[model samples]
Target: MTAESALTPTPAANAAGLPLALDAVGGDHGAVPNVDGAVQAARAGVRVMLVGDRVKLHAELSKYPGAAGLPLEVVDAPDVIGMDEHASDVRGRKDASINVAARLVKDGQAAALISMGHSGATMAASLLILGRLPGIDRPAILTHIPAKTGTVALLDAGANADVKATYLAQWARLASTYLKVVEARENPTVGLLSIGEEDHKGNAVTLEAHALLRQQAGINFYGNVEGGDLFKGTTDIVVTDGFTGNIVLKLAEGEARVLFGWIREALGSSARSKLGGLLVRGGLRTVAEKMDPGTYGASILLGVRGLSYIGHGSADARAVKNALLRAARAHQSRLIERLSTELSGPS
Candidate 1:
């Protein structure tokens, strides 16, 4: 099929305002948080299709009064893919919750798929079933990092560990399109993550990618940005291979938790500190909320033919709710279609 035609959603999939398909049994604590999150999203006016063992899912739904009244439907998926299972296991378990959820999107029964399950399995199912967007060599995970100014878009968060310079350049274009269409950013700037801010600072891969990005049209290519620049909001988008990007993402998450814990402990150590803490409690809470990974929830699997979001395995109800809402918003915004046009257009 032509690249454009391949990227186009089936008519059923394109039907206005379809519900988001959620893997109800895929997470550290399966079913409970997923059901609660689905209920929360339904209350917020987003339709949800919960895919899991129907009996277990219904039992969980019973915990919330009037949950039956919400815009929620359960799709029976008898199998489950454990967090420890290899992603390739999806091939053997076609009835797995993640696979079933992905099928909903492929069949046009849902607009998107959201899973707080096995990350590898989620990515595998998305790529195998929905296929890649035209001109996309490999799909990358787009993650949002809270920055001093605003959120910074980081791609290849954990998709392809070893990548070529060309892949990095393509990700820059993808990240740019995503920020503009989904984030409403105008002419978003791109940054190549490297050892230093200089053009010749990085290793062979980054050095080559920097050259490609400088000449690439459409995106506002910012020069090299160091690791520290991520929090400084040095650029609207940061491009890196999955290995480095994944490390950056995990390190940021760990540091944020440790720092916040230290702050709370110090604030509660004495009456004098407690008094000061009380005074700044509201402000601290506002900052804490902004830093919460749950605030943005899942990472977007960009360059796929359809929308698929992979949430943290330990995601709580709040994270799940946010993920569902975000996926719905992206689909409503026609993100995939817009990305296809941008990728297929003049370079």
Candidate 2:
């Protein structure tokens, strides 16, 4: 179809009321992984709309057996926006894959959109196309980080650089709802990122957020939590601005890498070390595999009118499949509509 039709912002809810739009063109590994994920999601009984080059997607579809006659449909667009293109530049490039995915949600063709492409473009396209749910100042990206204790929903991972105490409170609400829908938790503990657990700790913004989150009756605020508390899963949801959340996310990932390297070095140090490594290799591999970010697939861009998942640029087919499953789960759980109401309350 034409670019104007592709960019149209339709409501996400369908007549039957499913909530997911499987973005077939999103991902760093090109259309193979994306199409594979779509096929997998369709097999899993998820409703998906593929938005990308029809020729390439159909060719990929032919490679997979039993993928025929699925509920998936391809909306063709002649152009595609690249991952390197700045988010700001995507609006001018209407045929960008993310834009087409967002349009599916916007025009009532799908309930939500899932993408593994550039996060900036996803957020920008969602905002520019689907617009924000009422009362949400900005759309926040939520990552379901697999922590030491359990998974925690970290918000504003890269949506808004600047934030406010009120926004933090809103994040708490949105994240609480997210955990509830995804993890089936009624009251997930909400933690404000801080230097210490004390009330007086942290910078001006965090301190203010601490007070606001505490006062937010809608959220299950658990008071201040330090950066170290992240992997400990001290809280079910961690609320912070994009700046801090992104940095913390990267650091956590980096530390995981460093530890893996150290283990490798230590395991091969000598014969004695090799023997010791053999003893613990299974357990170590289990932890390493579980802790890998690729295992989680992609992060969800929450607080928008629809589902917009941002996958890692380096994501492989497995990661793509995981993201599609996430999109399906989010749609089944009515995550976006639920989050909108939780964040905005009654009109």
List model 1 lDDT by residue over 14-132, tens digit each.
Answer: 23378889999999999999999889888777888999999999999999999888888999999999999899998889999999989999998899999999999999999999999
For candidate 2, give the lDDT of residue 63. 91
Return the clash pairs for model 1, or none. Answer: none
Worst 10 residues of 1 by lDDT: 2-11
What is the lDDT of every predicted structure here? 0.89, 0.76
TM-score for each candidate, following the candidate numbering? 0.94, 0.89
Number of backbone collisions per candidate: 0, 4
In the range 48-135, model 2's lDDT, one tens digit per residue, is 6778888988898899887776667777866676778777877797877777778878897777777777778888889899887777
